[model samples]
Target: MRTFLTLFIALTLGLGWGLAARAEGFLGVYEDLPLAPGLTEVEGSGLSFDSPGGRIVEGYATGAVEAAEILKFYAATLPQLGWARDSDTLYRREAEVLKIDTEVDGGALAVHFTISPE
Candidate 1:
């Protein structure tokens, strides 16, 4: 099953470092994406979402691009639809790395995420 995929930068900038970075649990076709504020996963398109979590566009990888670049893309596409940033959660571990969970106002399309080094 495809899981939340990370759009990495070590690979996006064409660094060719071949670092130990890898993409795992990258899922597509998110279903029942919550579009409301209180509820969750009501209705979603198998293709595009212009609501809250709807900002999550496919055909992109975090492990393949810089964080700044990924942010830029989201910034450009999200605001165009007036999707508001409800909250951004950060997950971290002891002596480990930091992971980020981005929440939006796509109603029930609640897309939660966190990333760590591999």
Candidate 2:
């Protein structure tokens, strides 16, 4: 069952390595920012930190999802997830991490993050 779930997610959401895959109960505990719907993680695009401060996820959106929509989703949702958006940077008060999203392609939003404990 675990293998199936992993395979399903890999096929459906690309090679993801987030909290959802490790601890379902923890959910967003590890992944401070959520990936937009239909976005699949590009292979070799996952990065994490030993300290609870940094993680980066890169992926492309499937279907006809536009970049604007994806940006809107993050703009609206990040705050609800305890992130403060100052210009293009997202600072998580609760997590102490900084996150920024950029477009690598027309439908791809690459989220770059780093831990800032201070």
Candidate 3:
């Protein structure tokens, strides 16, 4: 029983730390944007500082969250982060484009987000 308790505690703490570390990578321009609840960053699904002109981030997140909620969340939040919304796309005042699309992929939702300067 004591051994089981120790293992459980270690697993719990390790999981929390892993989540935090995963979130820490999305700093700078991505600071205002947030990952959907219960979603973790997919490996090799992100690109940062790719060029002098743009950056791209794309990946799938597995969660029970609804697609509409994810869209609504960004629709409302991006403007607050200084990205102007025009229909389904967002644009920065400096001509950067933030495109987002989501669809059901297997048991998870595939999220594609790309931002590029025009």
Candidate 4:
């Protein structure tokens, strides 16, 4: 009984931690937004606000990965999160729009993400 209790507690804690980590967003910018793998958030580049209209957010991330890979990641991931692709780099969900843009920076790709009221 003692061994079973300890195992149960450990499993519960481990599951909670795993869920929290999975739900965390890039740079802590937006709670519901997902970050692409192999990218790191740009320091001091996140912006977020809530106005009467709605919420707005912007942030940047950089990675050594190819632009196509990043695009593919979002393309496959965003729709599952309720965002419908509006274009190659734009997505929409309910009352907001999410746009993704990338630029080559010193052999790395700099990704700019913006969320605004639709």
Candidate 5:
């Protein structure tokens, strides 16, 4: 049991560190998106950065890979990052897009996106 406990703690710490490491600008923002339910499309307002502004996209869904913006936000914001789709679990969301249970192909949350340095 000691070994198992040690492994568990290590795994937990690793996961936290991973999340923190990925937490930059928008990626960190996306990570904090709430998961509730009754979502169909993206919602949110834009902000200023360059000339016009960057619109904060928000989408709501329950247990389905609906919007790609939320995941893409992290993927594009992170280096060589991307998200997957979760067809196995149902997700409910509120406020921002919730990166739900995604396949472990890349990251824990199937973000379903691509990171571009542009």
Candidate 6:
């Protein structure tokens, strides 16, 4: 009985740790910008800098997901993160604008994400 209880405690801690890590966002692309599931960041495709205006970030990710699904995901998700949908591919927050562009690359969909000062 003691051994079974110990095992359960260990599993519970492990599951909680996993969930916390997953909530930290994928790829570390941009803070508060959620990467859609099934997409992975492209190597050496991230750029970030701070200008007099504000910060700018650019990155790319690729996945096998459909374009419509990607769009739908962001439309539903971004607002929850304080981003307002300005258009089908653009979102605006307090002082920044995020632009998302996707294209078919080989057999995968490549997404380019850009965030700039508004």
In terms of lDDT, the best-performing candidate is 4
lDDT of 1: 0.29
Extract clashing residue pairs from model 4.
none
- TM-score quality measure for candidate 2: 0.49
**lDDT ranking, high to low:** 4, 6, 3, 2, 5, 1
Kindly report which residue stretches of model 3 are placed more than 4 angstroms away from their true locations once superposed.
Answer: 1-29, 50-60
lDDT of 6: 0.75
Query: What does candidate 5's lDDT look like per residue over 45-100, in tens digits?
Result: 21212223322433332234334543443343222222232332322222212223
> Candidate 3's residue-wise lDDT over 1-118, tens digit each?
4365335434534676333222322323344445655455565656656666665544444455677766766666556445688765455635567777777778777666667776
TM-score of each: 0.25, 0.49, 0.61, 0.76, 0.19, 0.77
Task: Tell me the tens digit of each residue's lDDT in model 1 across 2-116.
Answer: 1221223323224533221222222344321112122222234234344432233322122323344334333333232223333323322222222233334433223433223
Q: After superposition, how far is residue 99 of candidate 3 from its true place, in Å?
A: 0.5
For residues 9-118, could you state the per-residue lDDT of candidate 4 as single tens digits?
34534676432233224446775566777688887889999989999999899989899988877887667566899887999988999999999999999999999998
lDDT of each: 0.29, 0.47, 0.55, 0.76, 0.31, 0.75
How many angstroms is residue 51 displaced in model 1 relative to the true structure, after the best TM-score fit?
18
TM-score of model 1 relative to the true fold?
A: 0.25
Residue 9 miss distance in model 6 (angstroms): 25
> What does candidate 2 score in Cα RMSD to the true structure?
9.2
- The positional error of residue 97 in candidate 2, measured at the CA in angstroms, is 3.1
Off by over 4 Å in 2: 1-29, 51-64, 106-118
**lDDT by residue (tens digit), candidate 6, 15-78:** 7632222322444556556677667888788988999999999989899989887787788766
The model with the greater TM-score, 1 or 6, is: 6
User: In the order shown, what is each candidate's alpha-carbon RMSD?
Assistant: 15.9, 9.2, 11.5, 8.7, 15.3, 9.7
Instruction: Please give the distance, in angstroms, between residue 77's alpha carbon in candidate 5 and its true position after superposition.
Output: 13
lDDT of 3 at 50: 61
